[model samples]
Target: MFGLFKKKSEKQKLQEAYQKKMSEAHKVSHSNRTQADKLMAEAEEIAKKIDQLKV
Candidate 1:
């Protein structure tokens, strides 16, 4: 597919990482709230980086 040749940009990569971390946090929330909180914090940091790239 043509999409296979496309490379992800920095912002896109960060966004993907943020989304992955958030999903992990949501899953962890069910049994390990502390770990979930940590994952959420990491996701927030990624989001901040993404925001910085926009400015």
Candidate 2:
């Protein structure tokens, strides 16, 4: 009867998106915080962008 089930809540969607973005960012080869931050920013608009990754 309920074929049209509701989708994930806003919070869930945001969290999922955040995690996915972070994962993608981490996979990339970033030299410094300046670049890393930019990649991370793509995931969460509110989170501060990291310039470079420590790794």
Candidate 3:
């Protein structure tokens, strides 16, 4: 596919990472509240970076 030749931009990479962190946080929430909170915080930080990149 032509997509293979393309690289992700910084914003795209950060967004993907944020989504992944949120999903992990959701999955961990039930078994480990503390870890899930940590993941959520990380996702928040990533979200901030994504916002900064948008400007």
Give the per-residue lDDT digits (tens) of candidate 1, residues 1-55: 9899899999999999999999999999999999999999999999999999999
Write down the lDDT of every candidate, Cα atoms only.
Answer: 0.97, 0.61, 0.96
> Which stretches in model 2 have alpha-carbon errors above 4 Å?
1-6, 30-35, 46-55
Model 3 over residues 1-55: C-alpha lDDT tens digits?
Answer: 9899899999999999999999999999999999999999999999999989889
Error of 1 at 35 (Å): 0.1
Which runs in model 3 stand beyond 4 Å of their true positions? none
> Could you give candidate 2's per-residue lDDT for residues 1-55 as a string of tens digits?
5747867765666667778778767766354666667768777672323222212
TM-score of each: 0.93, 0.52, 0.94
Span of 10 residues, lowest total lDDT, candidate 3: 46-55
